[model samples]
Target chain A: MAHLAMATGFLLILIGAWGALTNRNLLRMIVAFTIADTGVNLVIIAVGYMRGRTAPIIDGAVSAADAVTRIIDPVPQALVLTAIVIGVGVTALMLAYTYRLFEKKRSLDIRDYTDLKG
Target chain B: MIKRFIALALVVAVGSVFATLLFGYTPDADLNLTARYYAERTAADLGAANIVTAIVVTYRGLDTLGEVTVLFLSASIVGLVLAKGTHAPHRTPVPVGELLTTGTRFLVPLILLLGVYVFVNGHLTPGGGFQGGAIIASGILLLLLADPLKHFSHSLISAIESLAGIFYVMIGLAGLFLAGGFLDNRILPLGTLGNLASAGAIPLIYSLIGLKVGAEFASILAALSETEEL
Candidate 1:
């Protein structure tokens, strides 16, 4: 099941990449890039999950020994969470730049905003 | 049309054959021993039940530090780009909806509290400093959007960010001086496993990270929202 989820995520990422590269609208491209980035993060987190494991906690129902035995790996979850937050930050910055670009160029089309032709 | 269809089919067939030959599926072996070893060692040395947090904040703290620096650098670049002799957006002075303004005024404190709680209890639970810090920044963003008239204090945010960043570096260097390695956890007492105070230097480092991230994000939002000409 996890493998299937990872495969789906990879598929999404590829599609997103295609959309980002081929899309004419700058906003749509940014959205596609975000989708691709999120798909990658999802694939990473999915890889950390196991078939039938509890959360990594040693509480009343589960002893430390049992916790060790039943829990899926949590390291990837933590790392992915961090990556997701950073992704949000980057996306926000990208949106801000997009806004600025739109304001200056007065258009959302990528081809229209090309001022750096040399 | 027939020739194009034949070429497409041939390409697909060849790609599939190549994929099957190059990347045949292999059954993965269960590595119970390695998992057990890591679990036991993490529980013993890290003193945090959440091995993920332990590994991120302690065992691989240097990496986390670098990650935080990356965030800082990105924020800096954003600020620099936006600051380049640009005028702020024309202030139309559009009246904010009273519902949003009042609702966000009520929500800000609660969100801030929740963010702090998440950061402080990171070692014991699923959430950590970076997540919590970003949450706090989101709250600030909400406030900024809802109440355009209200503004964050720039000097305070800058001071806090710089101080937090410098303090983080100083802490890592102190660890290097005391424990002979940057970001070593030996400086603080590694208390019992699963305790809040356990994981020496981890919580402190994460707290610094949270502070830095929060301030940097808030400032980035502020810079973007500024209506004044640069």
Candidate 2:
């Protein structure tokens, strides 16, 4: 199960990287980046998974006494929480930039903008 | 064509590295040192039902604070970049169908309520501030989708966000002064485990984080919606 999830994550990252590298439209590139971001999160989750354990929550089903043997790693869960929130914020910023670029150039294509101010 | 081939080659190389890592990786039979420490002590040290909540709200709270600051910065930057002028665009929005408008009205209140529930009970359940905050913002999103021209008070959203952020910091400072260290959960009497009020100030901190995050997201959504040509 761990390897499967890890492989899927790697596939997603690769797909996202491919799309971001080849896509001409800024919007597509952003979408691709998010895919890659999702993959990174997934890989982290997979790395933290335990074979026979459940979630990290200390509930009735999994008592606090035996939590050491019962629960999956909580560190990765916390990291993923922060990552997902930051991902949203980053995506929002990306969209904002995309909107600005669109407003200025009236184009979503990346090649339209010239960097040389001279 | 050459650029595309190069991109593909790079992707392949990266994928090969990933494959190697995946193949060599063996799932840990035992919790690592840090994970074991959290698992063993989080309950007694924090009295939080959710171990992850304990880690996020208190154990590694400084990182979470920085995380929220990053979010605030992102939201602020987006709002700043998008808000061109005080006046909104004057274009009339096409009427959304009755199904969406009515469904949103019926569903939005429930979603907002659920968001509150999630964040308020963050200490015990799987959900926490960020999840609840996103849920609340989703409700706002639904509202905006129903009426594209809907104008939410920017000041109100900012006020909520700012107040929540202030209180969050104040609570952290309180931990610094009253408890073990900064963002410590033991200040407010850890309470009984698994109960509603068990995890010291986790619920309070999480609720604040939820409100702050929700307001930031709502403001961002409002800013973006306002920017729409419709």
Q: Tens digit of lDDT per residue, candidate 1, span B58-138?
A: 667777777777777777777776765544456565677889789898999998998888887777777777878888998
Candidate 1 ranges beyond 4 A from true positions: A57-68, A113-118, B1-37, B84-90, B227-230
Q: How many backbone clashes are present in model 1?
A: 0
Per-candidate DockQ vs. reference = 0.35, 0.86
Which pairs, if any, clash in model 2?
Answer: none
| lDDT against the true structure, each candidate | 0.72, 0.94
Worst 10 residues of 1 chain B by lDDT: B22-31
In terms of docking quality, model 1 is acceptable
Clashing pairs in 1: none
**TM-score of candidate 1 to 2 decimals:** 0.84
Best candidate, DockQ? 2
lDDT of 1 at B131: 76
lDDT of 2 by residue, B1-230 (tens): 99999999999999889988988999999999999999999999899999999999999999999999999999999999998775456677889999999999899999999999999999999999999999999999999999988999999999999999999999999999999999987779889999998899999999999999999999989989888572
